[model samples]
Target chain A: MSWLLALPFFIPITTALIAFLARGRKHLCSVISITGCFAALCVSIAIVTLVVSGGPQAAQMGDWQAPYGITLIADRLSAVMLLISAIVGLCVALFAISDINENRVKLGFHCFFQLLLAGVSGSFVTGDLFNLYVWFEVMLIASFALLVLGGEKIQLDGGIKYVALNLVSTLLMLTSIGLLYGLTGTLNMAQLHISLAEVDNPVAISTLAVIFICAFGIKAAIFPLFFWLPASYHVPPVAVTAVFAGLLTKVGVYALIRTFTLIFPNDLGFTQNILLGAALLTMLTGVLGAAAQYEFRKILSFHIISQIGFLILGLALNSPLALAGTVFYMIHNIVAKTNLFLISGTAQRLAGSYELNEIGGLYKASPLLSTFFFIAAFSLAGFPPLSGFWAKLLLVKASLDQTAYFVTAVALITGALTLFSMSKIWAEAFWKPHPQGHCKSLYSLSVAERLQRLLPVSLLASITLILGFMPEPFIEYALGTAGELLHPDDYLEAVLTGSSH
Target chain B: MNSIILQTATRVLVALILVFSVYMLLRGHNYPGGGFIAGLIAASAFALFAMAWGMEAAQSALRIPPGNLAVSGVALAGLSGLMAIFYGDGPFSGQWLTLIGAKEEDGIVISNVLFFDIGVYLTVLGAVLTLIFALEEAS
Candidate 1:
């Protein structure tokens, strides 16, 4: 059973080694990468089924007891997270086969790609806080390598800012973890939950909670700490940016949700209010920043920050429904956002540039590409009958149920602003005539090349459509995860008593 | 590329460092000297070798690219954990076996835990050397 949890990360780490070893053999590397991702996907599905049917599962490394040895736990949240990550990972790996050129692969792009997947999978399943930190570093290091893989001057500049800010946040997280350990005398999250309750000093715990907020806040790219995101995210290739945009900040958001719900539930008054204020600001500022951008990818990058605000809003509400809404929104946004980036990549290939002013006529050149852009872009903007609409509706309803009128208004306004920026992209990149009156067409590409590029884009877009049309099961799952999170007794018992199944 | 004295010292130092690194790796299970430090020591020996001789000598000495070495290290370290799974234990659970003919009074033991340590030793050494060699050769 524990092996099921380990396989998600283990498959990727091992595949990375094999892929790197077979560096010059593109066919071999692709085979290894694809097979690894497929295995991880299968394992994730199995683990999710077990969690949904049985309950949370845990396994101590080296057979060590709880609160002593490193542990891996797969509760509802972790299982769902792993399932989504594997899905995106496999898709991106397939996409990269055609999207990434020969020179980049020779620079170990496939290796780092798998390593990043390993890190994300590890982050989801880890049962200890320090182990979580280790996973963050794993993800961070791989991301840094991926970000600057091309060694272009602009990428290096972006990479420096990305690393510098994240390093500061990492140090801050470490400091808080150290303090939390001193306070509770344990690094295991379940143990910390119990130990934190036993502590008498609310002031000290509150201070430590603030440190955690600052740390994860920066990583999550909430307002005032989001400068690094827009600066760095657009510099990487579309495939790299797609994965980072989809997973990286979400890890920060995941940590925030996990910590606030499990460890610091005692002082919602102090933390929730702070989060509410930040959430509103993040939404407004992120959308406004997007409105100011002309590059297709740049606009999408700012949207990542704004969408994070909606997710954070659900966390601040801290109600069961609100948390469930956040979970649903997270799933919806990841697929939709990643598809948008992937579509932008194909569009860029046809349009001959990412700059909106220099490129146009895509709608006439390739209506197929235009349709993909429409579905993804509008879905991101919360258009009705699409995935984003449902995600936004849940959040709006959650806010209304709590009578947080201010938050409700902010969310709606942000959605409107998002639509505006997305429409701006549509008008510039797709709807309008080319500034030069001519643009390359996707139809010009070979059949195999076209399929390789559009396969992942269509796959992800279909998922968004499925999540929209058939949202009942996903909603039920999210609510169940919310219930488990709000009441963590099952997770605690699973780890403390060893896995029951 | 290097002074005669420096080249002479590198040869002896490299051999001594490699031997000491093995000692540290073996003792790491119960002591402070572990795979990480031992790997660093081994990498430093090669780094010193690279400095004394040219990049070509270091390349010939390694006999494989540092990138490939790091890849193998990661694979070895990860596979070591699978030993427990075959033994019907949890992932990464330690599996031990006593030598078949050894007497109890011999005071020596062997385990899969040591395999994991060796994997770590290789990973750190390979990864560090990869980074240093890339920068050195590029410059």
Candidate 2:
């Protein structure tokens, strides 16, 4: 059982080792990477199935009992997140075959990529707070390497900002963890849940909660701290950007959700207002930033911030339905956002630049690519019968149910602004005639390159479509997850009462 | 660097530091020293060697790319964890072997924890050297 839980990250670490050793051989390294991601995806699916059937699963490392040793626990939330992230990881690995150049591959791109996935999976499944911090560092290092892989002037500039701010966040997170551990005498999250409830220091707990929000907020790119995201995300290779766009911030948001729900479930009166205010500002500033962007990937990067706002808003609302909305929105955003970055890469490949005004005629050169862009972009904009629409609907309904009219207004306005930005990209990048009088068609790409690039984009777009068209099962699953989160008795039981031996 | 005294002293110092590092690593599980500090000690030896002789000389002395060595160390540590699974225990559970005695506690006790520690030793040694070498070369 523990091995099953461990495989999602374990396989990736092993793959990273092999891929690094095989770095001199491009094809073999990519094959190993893809196979590793596929295996992780399979493990994730098995874990999800097991969690669904068996309630929740927990494992103690080194046979140490809970509250003492490291524990890895997976409820519905962790399992589903693991599954979705694995899918994104595999898709990005497929796309990297063509998108990454030989120089980068020789620099051990596959190894770092797998390591990044391993970190992400570890972050999702670990049941210890300090373990989460370790996973975050793993992610930080791997992502820093990926961001600055080429060491281009632009990339280095971006990487410095990214690393600088993230390090501050890390320091704050570590401090907060230390404070919490001192207060509760436990680093295990489930144990903390029980220990915290017994404590009466409301002021200290509230302070720690705010510090946590600041730490994770920086990572989630919530308003004020989001500058690093746009500055850095656009500078990486599209495959790198795509995976970062898909999984990284969501991990931050996931941490926010987990900590808020599991350890700090009460204290709503204090934390709720702060989270709500941050969420509103995050949505507004992010969309406005996107509106001002004329670059392809930059616009998408800003939207990621805006979307993170909605996820946090769900957590702030603190209803079961609202948390469910957060889950649904996260999945929707990961698929749609990743797909958009990938399509931007394809669009750049076709039209020669990522600057909006410099490229056009995508619709004329290849309607198929344009259609893919439209599906992903409009889905991001909350078009009805699309995934984003349902995700927004859930949040909107959840907000209205709570009589949070102001929150609903901000959410809807942000949705409209998001649509405006997507249409801007459409008008400038896709719908117009080429400024240079020529745009390359998809047919110009070699068949292998075409397959490598387009297949992931198409698969992600189809996932967006599936979630939009058939959201019943996913919505139900999310509701169940929210129930578990709201009442963490089962999670606590799984982690604390389960036999370590 | 051109001083013969510094180079000659480094030759003797590197060997001593390395042996001490191994000693620290071996006594780590029950004592104050462990893989991490031992690794730092060993890496400083190479750093001193690099400073005295230069990066290429240190690289040759190491006999493997630090990056590869670091990766293999991680693989070794991970594989050590997997050993517990084969013994019908959870991943990372310590498994012990008595190589020299009849009783469990009376023998020369060895455990997977030692392997795990060794793995950590190699990883830190390699990683620190990788950084130090890069910095030295860059400068």
Q: Runs in model 1 with CA error above 4 Å?
A: B102-108
**What TM-score, computed on C-alpha atoms, does each candidate reach?**
0.98, 0.99
Interface RMSD against the true structure, candidate 1: 1.1
Error of 2 at A79 (Å): 0.6
Q: Rate residue B123 of model 1 by lDDT.
A: 84
TM-score of chain B of each: 0.91, 0.95
**Candidate 1 falls in which docking quality class?**
high
Which stretches of model 2 miss by more than 4 angstroms?
A499-501
lDDT of each residue in A286-355, candidate 2, tens digit only: 9999999999999999999999999999999999999999999999999999999999999999999999
Per-residue CA lDDT of candidate 1, range A234-264, in tens?
Answer: 8988999999999999999999999999899
Q: List the residue pairs that clash in candidate 1.
A: none
lDDT digits (tens) for residues B81-100 of candidate 2 = 98987789988999987789
For each model in turn, which proportion of the native inter-chain contacts is also found? 0.93, 0.89
Q: Pick the candidate with the highest DockQ.
A: 2
State in Å the error of residue A321, model 2: 0.9
Model 2 interface Cα RMSD in Å: 0.7
